[model samples]
Target: MRNCWFATPGIARPMSIRCWSSRWRRMPMASDRKLTAFFLGFAARHKWRFLLSVLAMPIYAYLVAEAPNVMRRAIDDGIMAGDRAATIRHSLVYLGCMVGGALGLVAQHWFMQSGGIRTLTHMREAVMRHILGLGRAEYDKRPLGVYVSRSTSDVEAIGETMTAGLTNLIADTLLIVFIFVNMVAIDRKLGLMTLVIVPVVVVVVDIFRRILRPLYDRIRTVNGTLTSQINEVLGMHGVIRSFHLQGAFNRLFREDNDEYRDTNIKAVSYDAAVFSILEGLSFVAIGGVLLYIAVRATGTEKALQLGAVVAFIQWLQMLFPPLKQMGARFAILQSALAAVSKLETVMQIPLPVDEGTKSPENLNLTVRDLTFAYNKEQPVLKNVALEVPAGKSLAVVGPTGSGKSTLIRLIVRQFDLNPGGGEILLGGTDLREILREDLRKKIVLIPQEPSIFEETVRYNISLDRPEVTMERIESICRKIRAHDFIQHLPHGYDTVIAGEGANLSMGQRQLIAMARALATDAQILIFDEATANIDTETERLIQEALDYVMATRTTILIAHRLSTIRDADQILVLNHGEIMERGTHDALMTRPGLYRRMYELQRHAIPDQ
Candidate 1:
């Protein structure tokens, strides 16, 4: 059903009522309908305010259309007849109509602005919620900057169109209609003659729009690309500075900026051309009316009155401004349509699947017949199986690209297993049957490079978990031997750390990670090379913390330093995504396997230790 709906050509995509539903579902594809149709459907959700805004337009247009007729009366009935009282009366009525029309215009602006804001706010929130629900695979496939553009720039463009562009479109259209009708009623011959220029003006405007549409789209695309590049360069500031590549990055940014500037210049040129043509056409329409009036005055049978000619001219002047503005408004509508199409493209990405129902206890970890690959061509972890009883420590040792980190990610459900690939069990319940949040609470994996936010040490350690008291945080920090360093900081536990812990040493960050792991109090802990790249003294401190953490919890350690995992209850040696050996350190050492050879080589290389 979903495929058929999206597959049908020229079909309008209906707005989903449950756009923010939590349940995982496939993202809807972009519709084939015109952009205006999609926008109208979006606005339909807030129909009452939209209708009020539309209603105000015609009311203002009616009052404006009536002003010229009142002036005709002031001239033909009062001024020419030399009746001062009648002239004043007609003049006052015209003034009242203009004042009333201005108030109606204000009301229309307010209503349209309010409606646009409400609708786009909901859209922004829904898109963000959908993004949050997506899995890690989606994030890995796209840059962070791409998502940022979708949320910020694209949304703002759509909002601007809805608030100002849409209102002007309706109001100008109605004003044109009202003026044309009044001109005909007052002077039919001149009205019909003036109507001849309408088709020519429309054709010219249409030609300009056709030229401008693709240019505007290209401009928007370039702007998004430039924004993405800027974000990427800024994020890699540390790496670029370290490698002395500042000039290279700057040159790349300049190239993108130049392209963006050129595209914008082209779009603006096209817009100005359109506006200039419309302005010239408006003056031509007025001249055509004057010529028609003069031609009628020479006719013997159907003479035009001076008052009626003046009224027709007034109506023609009023009509041309709206016509001129229509071209620009159409361009805004096109830009908004482009932005909406981009937004719909993002909305179509399916949410991550989570069908788990069972919450397990005891949390003894098991992996059976595990076979997986990030890509189909090569398997990363093949036919792997393992069992870890509660409170037992299992250490996995492997060379680079041996699927050590992949195994850890699978346990945490960062990526789902392939269909029929394998099954993971926690407390004898299938891992697929446990909610992800519940599974995470029972098992925590601390990566080698921990992420530190720009927040206080206390918040960093506990993550502001409600059940984790300040005393508990301090106790855990003390246990990990991080309390002393934290205390020595300017504000102790209250000290605000810089982003990624830039203000602290690598050892301090590792200590904080250890404290965070202990704070979770989960049944199982997996450390992926947690002590890598640290000094020997820091390694000793982390090892001590690891020993204390492993005493009562089931732990999985991926270590490059053999000494750190020598005391594990069981050790697994993996090579090329397959487990080649599994046994205790002493048992593995007695055998001529990969583990013993690697251990011997490491010990000989570092004999001083």
Candidate 2:
């Protein structure tokens, strides 16, 4: 009766991912138990309907076998015995069973679909939560394409396995088994003769199927590639126009399109061959069964009765459809398996930073002998050390790729992984020792590419916090220059934004992001190159928000434009993962270092700076 499914390929859930502890602990990896259990749990709640449906199966099977018996009674007990009334009665009884079977079949199909969809919804929600709960580092390592497929196509493939697959498998398997059992029971020799064709059919079908599968898979891959081409071209339409490379882009598109067509045609040809072969073999086998039955049948009366013979023929015809359908769905099954493999690989990658189990109690912030690199061979930051006094602002300046943003990420615990490393401490508290929930409240990172969800601006900025007042929102928006745009629009603050705030400009989006960070109201704030994309008009407004943000919080400001951070309590110059210099901005500009050079260049780039 457990409501949890623990069948993740090979990955352990993050401790934070456990919504239910007892059920979570029972997760079983590397076994179908979790998968089977998931189904049982889904079916158990609605078991009464399922049980009723299952009961219908035997009735279906019995009626099927009974129809032949009725024909036998009509011929032997009625016609041969000279009882015409019995013949009519048996005929009517046979018709009634068929009608009942048809009704039961409808209910049975409905039940399977209902169960499949219910399971699909549950799994979709859980996977969505798991993806959402995954820390930033995991998201960075994977592509948007992968997550998109996981949620849509991949999950759908698995859902097919749950619903359509479940329905077909249950009906085919049970029906096939029922036929086999009854067939052998009635006449062992004839049944044995009919089964002679099974092994040959199975072997031939499997061989052709296996040969065709790879080509089908290639067709899928090529189609996805074509889709990728379209996405890339459309997403970068502005860039393409700027470069004046429409012809070149067209050429690339043609090549991908051609490849897709070629692969698709090849798969189609192979699939045609498989079905054609199945067709030829189907008649051969069925005809041979009839030959054997005809040879073994006794005097016309003693031989397999006409009714049994008709039912037997019907059974033979029924078998081919299930067999062919199972083959057709093989691709879906394979796709689900491959998706599981990819999902497993991702879940196995260790998250960059593992939050420890210790409690966080201090407000003191310090960095000591910090070292980090994107790769092992070349260090981006080396032997660096710095400190931020509680509630003070520290600015970091560096050239592009000089590791300034990396420094801020380390401080705010953005990576969540360990290989490319450094350590950050606050109030004698190692950042990793703090719980993630606590860390979110205490430390916040506002990235340059801030995300804007497709929702009302109020919902996007206020983040469902009931305490956020209209006055507070208006104040922050004004400070970030978003107030002008918000008020100018017809709907103002209540207007909804879609397509990731495509209705607004890039600068407008960043300002709204600033509002989001401000709303978090964390104790520590780090902004990594956040103001770079804002317009000159909005830059000053964002700076006002920054001023308010740093007044009573420990702040780490990363800047290429030095003017924004000149008033910072301390400025650290970072180079090659090392702290080359640290001092007040005015003092460092006079000292002949990277800070002075960056200041002069930025003053030219932005006259105000």
lDDT of each: 0.79, 0.67
lDDT of 1 at 555: 92
Candidate 2 TM-score, C-alpha based: 0.82
TM of each candidate vs. truth: 0.85, 0.82
Tens-digit per-residue lDDT, 62-161, candidate 2:
6654555566666766776788899888878878867876666666666666766776676567567667777666787778777776767656666655
Model 1 residue 259 lDDT? 82
Local error of candidate 1 at 274, Å?
Answer: 4.9
Off by over 4 Å in 1: 1-45, 206-277, 301-303, 600-609
Q: Tell me the spans in candidate 2 whose CA falls farther than 4 Å from its real position.
A: 1-59, 79-82, 184-189, 255-305, 326-364, 373-379, 416-423, 604-609
Worst 10 residues of 1 by lDDT: 17-26
